[model samples]
Target: MVKQIRAFNQLKELALSQEILEDSRTKGVVTALYEALKSRDAEAIQKILAPDLEWWFHGPPSHQFLMRLLTGEQESDFRFVPHSISAFGPTVLAEGFDQSRSIAWVHAWTVTDGIITQVREYFNTSSP
Candidate 1:
């Protein structure tokens, strides 16, 4: 009975450790992506995102600047300043306003294996 209990406890500890490690790895990727966005570092952005990344924007269709930034069609003149960031398992949510531009944005990211595979961005349309 004693040996069985010890074995179960060891297994539980191992599972917990693995979960923490994955969380750390996911946060690292999310943080790096935001840092790259702030600096407008195209190379860093490319490095952190998956090659086959899928991103969507929710706002007026007239607002094409954000899409341009993501597709590398145009350079970003705005810098996003995240006010709050939270991680729920492999997903990370960042909400803030742009310091360089008058835009409030909420970014939801899905990270897998240390790479951002999906992104959903919501921007305030009231801002010019």
Candidate 2:
């Protein structure tokens, strides 16, 4: 969690230092997270997620792990939705919708000498 906060702070500093530009589609992704969460739709989450994804929430990893590992619902009552978004470097912090609300997440973009090699997700636990 500290690492995530540090990364977010770094992003803020960088944004303050430069004229930041972002894609509208990325905003759509943020909205999509929200829509998905409101509906508790994993399919929606999958749609926004990159093919090679790695997600981590601030709380339990089970729901996400179950989605990836079991390929379906293990039990109901667990769900997440996305909220606002912020970009720092190659990282993205998307707030989640639901109960646990441990502050949603998604980290991506591997840089090599200043180019993105890969982008993926770091899913967060859902909350009410």
The residue-by-residue lDDT of candidate 2 on 1-29, one tens digit each, is 99999999999988766635443334445
TM-score of each: 0.76, 0.41
- Give model 1's TM-score versus the native structure: 0.76
Relative to the true structure, candidate 2 reaches a TM of 0.41
For each candidate, what is the lDDT? 0.80, 0.50
User: Per-prediction count of colliding residue pairs?
Assistant: 0, 12
**What's the CA error at residue 4 for candidate 1, in Å?**
3.7
| Lowest-sum lDDT 10-residue window in model 2 | 108-117
